[model samples]
Target: MEINQFLDATYLKTASQANLTEEETQQKVIELVKEAILYDYKLVMIRAIHIPLVKKILNEAKSNVLIGTVIGFHEGTYTTEEKLKEAKAAIVLGADELDFVVNYTAFKKGDLDLVRNEIIKGIKLCLDNNKVVKWILEVAALTNEEIIVISRLIKQIVFEDFGEENAKNVFVKSSTGFFKTKNNLPNGATLEVMKIISENAKPLKIKAAGGVRDYETALKMITLGVDRIGTSSSEEIIKREKNRNKGY
Candidate 1:
């Protein structure tokens, strides 16, 4: 089904996280950009620091692959101002999409105002900059009910405040692929969780990130109506897709 078009080729690890030198990390990003160019994947999702490098390479290659970066990554504890500031810098650095980790901690603490405020401001900033925006809910840390509520909350905020036309530019993403869960439980998008999100957060798009590693799982996500699949295994998935097409 030409799955590369639905993939957001992702590499969001830092040097320390991967135990690599800074140069090695840059090389990884370079290879990722090259792979995206080769496959014509929808976008290459990377850390904000690498936006300029990615932008330069894509521009030189004349590749239309979009650049996406995270804001308030991993943890959603950052204040709204901080998230907005990070997003502004990403925009300035040539990011076409901004995925902000939503402040679920505040929502868990019964601080609905904090959650609402950030979503409003964050979505506004990205829309104003003509950038696609996605709110990462970090489903691993949340209960099913929380996922339903937060998804609905985001949908409501975008539809009511931003109007129907702008809702298309927003996405309700499943995870940052960085949340630590108890007992090494699945830390990314699970189909069950995705179903809840998809039903609750419509009008806005859905991006199922983390734990989506192979062609079978990725195709399932697409069949389940996810608009984008974010993963670091784009090449492997593409290989599997080729095998399936070849009846191997």
Candidate 2:
């Protein structure tokens, strides 16, 4: 498969971390959008606040690269109502896809009803609005068994409640890329965890985010059936692919 087709070139940094003021942050997003257009990436993932700017830039350049944003990002602690509001506002701002951080903490605490309800609401809203939806499971923060259980749960919910075709538009994504981990272990997609997710989330689509920094690893994810890859290293990965193809 063509590697760039699976890449969601990302830049989700906050203003402070990126060392940019508000205007500068928008400029950075503009640059990212330009790069995504140049590379023919599948999408450009940015924060929700920048969706309008991204839409404007892509429109002016007449680029079709999709604009994606995260809701309850980096933390899946928002209430169902709150997440729905965020989703609606994002859709209004012209976001093509919505990646939501699932309420995994509640699930771990035996609050499966709450988790289920939230995910159901979130997915329905996105589907009804004709927007792609992805649930960020934050695998780095869960146990192996938790990963399987949650992945299965997401698939079960989407397929059973919304039918298989709608489930195809819903993705079980691997990470938010900001979850703090003990010992600084990789905080994003890992092959083993992805294998577990792919095995369980069949027909629901899978997106491997975080920690996917190089061309080799990205290709491995495609081999493992990842439909989308989220990374800040899209340019580097594409550059590496070009060099390798040229036998350099």
Candidate 3:
């Protein structure tokens, strides 16, 4: 299959959720997701607890795409146990993929084992749900060398935790919409993870988020081995795609 065919959209509908009521947010999500599918874009749900409700919407729309939820999102403060609970709960409610935030505090402590174990727990929880797990490394928090180390640690976790299934499910990501170091995302970090993704995450997927504002940046990532693009800018991106099509 063409990798382009495998490219998909992950919608971070946080502002929509905060700005609108649950029902309103969900209605808009359904409309956007249906539109994405019409454009042959695979849908990856981010944030918003209304995802399960949209699962039926996808089915009705005849869209065969993934429904994802963020686990311990935005910040990596959630403990290993909390992450496991969140993952299981999300899966029980129809989440097909779990994008788990890595335990940054543990990583900061140099507690590599704790980091790996937490990741393993998340992987197992997703597996139990008969689903896939994507580990968002939040690479903007890590230095260049740190990205490589984290990538290697992820490789080891995949090798030890759940074998090929987990590896296939795993994704290395640039940011989770918020950054501890930078107020906004850095393209250098985005390209840093792309470099790691190209060199390390061969079978694994790469999702680039944080400051992806236009079609050019998004397309550059897709061409560079990124499998998924997470953005709240989906509407703008699609409009750009359409304008490019119209050549106006």
Q: Over all chains combined, what TM-score does candidate 3 have?
A: 0.84
| TM-score ranking from best candidate downward | 1, 2, 3
Candidate-wise lDDT, in order:
0.95, 0.92, 0.71
How many clashes show up per model? 0, 0, 0
lDDT string, candidate 1, 213-248, tens digits:
999999999998899999999999999999999999
Superposed model 3: Cα runs more than 4 Å off: 1-8, 11-19, 180-189, 239-248
Alpha-carbon deviation at 16 in model 3, angstroms:
9.2
lDDT of 2 by residue, 1-248 (tens): 46888999999999997788988987888889999999899999999988888888888888879999999887899988889999899999999999999998998898999999988998899989999999999998899899999999999999888999886799999999988999989898999999999999988999999999999999999899999999999999999999998898
The Cα error of candidate 2 at residue 8, in Å, is 0.6
- Candidate scoring better on TM-score of 2 and 3: 2
| Worst ten in a row by lDDT for model 1 | 159-168
Clashing pairs in 1: none
Ranking by lDDT: 1, 2, 3
- The pairs that clash in candidate 3 are none
RMSD of each: 0.7, 1.0, 3.0
Native RMSD of candidate 3 (Å): 3.0
The residue ranges of model 1 lying beyond 4 angstroms of the native Cα positions read: none
